[model samples]
Target: MIGKLSSKEGVVNVLVSWLPLEDNWYARILDENLTILSLYETGDILLANHIKLENFVIKNILKLSAIYCYCGNSLSTKAYGLAHDQIRKCLFDMNYDKSDIVFNTNSAQLCSECDANFDRVNLPEDFKKNLKKDLKKLKKDFFYRVYDFVQTKPKISIVIATIFALFINILSNYLYEIIMGRANLPIFLVSPFVVIWNYFT
Candidate 1:
């Protein structure tokens, strides 16, 4: 199982685990001796794995200077499945301990004291509402940061396109001068007409 432990306020120790089961998964959080705890799970542990993979991909994309659409799309699916299986194996090895478990499936809830901590578990409507608010704030913050950066720098795409167009224009002009022997007409005049003719014919 994948586990992380941290201490808060020098008194409360938190352990989080993603545990694999014979046919399912478990996630538990516990204090020392697994006495005070929280657990979550469903028979289908694969859902948690899916979330983990999606989170990873989003983080990866955020770090990239440019996103390759095809590669990102292809890797996302594979990464999700692989993360699920790997987390399952990790949880299995941890023996589903409770004292230090944090994130896990929603199917089962057990504290370190072996008491049912999630017997009254239900989806909190307010949780989603709050989460949406936080997400919107985060999205706004990201866009604002990106806008600030763009304002301070030249756009890479525009710069690249301009250079490309200049190269093509120079090459075509050179070719025309070589073939036509510098006919007294302006290069721009001949170039546009040539482009139009090539497009239609």
Candidate 2:
């Protein structure tokens, strides 16, 4: 059993299972209550694409009260498991004081609890589609955060300068034709005037 929900009546427990990928393991999220709020085993997509799995859980399962992660024998070691310290650090980063989670090895006795009757429950048709959209948004948000972090440094000025140079290149020909009225003015000479004009306007 895990912690109680905010309602004190609706108990939410997330059960995690590890899937063997090519090199790394993928995790699947399943609520013990047989809810349709589950994410697919994204393999290395989460870590490789820099998607924030913790944010996904927090946004999609805002009402979750607890999480129960069951790992196989391979991940039974203290340093490696579905709910290891590395994962727990991210999960507990928010206001998780009211909720709790437990991780245990998949021993013979634990197999009984791990066997969830997922066939009986039919997920909605749009469940996977919605999950895909949410995942794309998560990846986008992660990149935006990374960009925000890097933008505060002095190196970002070089990026802005490069973009400005490209913008000037794109408009150089047109500005030259308009300025000389014969489409024969040198772009190098007209570019500075265009920049000054646009800046003043």
Candidate 3:
């Protein structure tokens, strides 16, 4: 499905898709004119077919300024962090600044990079306002779901759980670097949940 937000300069098109076999939800950005701009995809997808990404980005470099990549969630964590980092670095190498890039925890969340500077960007004031409202609702819904799942958990338990999650996140990132042969920040570290869970199981 495609969702769009308009700005005075252009419209930002959010294209969302799901990979049933891999259980990955992917979102990409396109300009107001329906011209493809950002090409952020799942790490697994990029690794499997990087050449296409390379060519597409190269062709649209002029029109592409900012990008938002969705890192995997608890039920599934692949190489999204690694893949996003690589793509951003590649864009940087091609002359895009680090600030031009942004990331979201999942399809439900707004782009942290873009949200922080919403007023400064070309996006319409109404769209930006609505996005902020949507983000709040999404966070609230997510919190309620988590709270229900782990009801009556002690404060200390929450603390310990958080620490353990960080530990595993760091370790998993290290393992991904070693396995993927690229040293970069773990993609999901910025997210609330750090554990990579299995959806197929």
Candidates' lDDT values, in order?
0.33, 0.37, 0.37
Runs in model 1 deviating more than 4 A are 1-154, 182-201
Model 2 / residue 169 / CA error / Å = 4.7
Residue-wise C-alpha lDDT for candidate 1, range 72-127, written one tens digit per residue: 31112222221222223121123334322223221112232211211223323353
Native-to-model Cα distance after best TM-score fit, residue 66 in candidate 3, in Å: 10
lDDT of 3 by residue, 160-198 (tens): 789999999989888889679787555765343434333
The candidate with the higher TM-score, 1 or 3, is 3
**Between the candidate structures 1 and 3, which one is better when assessed by lDDT?**
3
Model 2: residue 71 alpha-carbon error in angstroms:
16
TM-score of each: 0.18, 0.29, 0.27
- Among all windows of ten consecutive residues in candidate 2, which has the lowest summed lDDT? 101-110
Sort order, lDDT high to low: 2, 3, 1
lDDT of 2 at 21: 30
Flag regions of model 2 displaced more than 4 Å: 1-84, 87-129, 138-149, 152-160, 169-173, 184-201
TM-score of candidate 3 to 2 decimals = 0.27
